[model samples]
Target: MTPEPTLAALLARLDRVEAHQAVADLMSSYINACDLAKDIDRIVEHFTPDAVWEGVGRNIEFGTWQGREAIAANFRGVQERQPFTYHYLTNQEIRVADDALSATGRWLCFEPSTIREGTLPVWIGLAYDNTFVRDGDQWFISHLAVDTLFATPYDKGWGVEMFTPVTAPKEPSHA
Candidate 1:
């Protein structure tokens, strides 16, 4: 017969499981808050005080913001630009550290958005790479890096032709 785990061993296993769940919950809450776009404070609370948020890829202007306040502002800016947005996340993978106090996760996101004055609704696919930190008993996002895979108008589906990166030609230098 297999020997039963000691109390300390069981507790360690529980801590790792809890850490994984916490990371998952944090990501879910982030997407929910963004979709609602009503409570910025609620979204800001998910991040650490010195957290960093970065967005890269072709659809939108790439930018990085540091600190909770800056991250909150970035989210607010997104809300302002996209009047309505529905975000979907899938294929999430979280890796908990041995200490059970930190973790890293990745998720795939599909976002359909309605712009304030735009005639066509836009759809975006992106990847999220996140780092989570546990402070006391609460887990917060330490870093969120988003890589936009594709952005297309709903009328025009995302196909082979849309695989190319969106780019703008550089302007002529006056000098």
Candidate 2:
């Protein structure tokens, strides 16, 4: 007799691996876009219409943006001194849980901005406590918290936006 693989067994196997990499990839693009734009509207769409983005930004900036309007406004506020900026995400450590439906990850945040003279990059590695959602036919970050652990200023005088026709990064490689 041939062996039949049970459906429950397959799903259980699926739960063993992280399922939020796609979401992470999409989110990385969002972060990149925000840094690229002189304005924040372009990247604000990634968040939910009523999403709240709060963190210890300049002057201890932290608040809950009610919706698209509020979120965009808040980003614009922080982006005032951001014509020259870089948002780098790396060293990602992802964790899967809740039967392959939810997951979390750690991301190191780096920014190259002006401090005194020439531009220099500073490391502000932080923990990205995130929650994923299977939205429609794809995954999205339903909730994301960026907790800052370390930060320092640069001295190279961050350069103005210099991207020559930006293109989205390639999709997440599962290989």
Question: All candidates' TM-scores?
Answer: 0.85, 0.64
RMSD of 1: 5.1
Q: Positional deviation of 47 in candidate 2, in angstroms? A: 1.7
Model 1, 14-117: lDDT tens digits are 99999999899989998888787557898888989888887766555457878878777766666665667788999999999999999999999888876543
- lDDT by residue (55-173, candidate 2, tens digit) is 53332224445456766675565554333567678788776675666566667776654322223344333456656555454555556666655445433122432221111112211
For this target, which candidate reaches the highest TM-score against the unseen true structure? 1
lDDT (CA) for every model shown? 0.78, 0.54
Off by over 4 Å in 1: 1-3, 58-61, 116-119, 160-175
Q: In model 1, what is the error at residue 140, expressed in angstroms?
A: 0.2
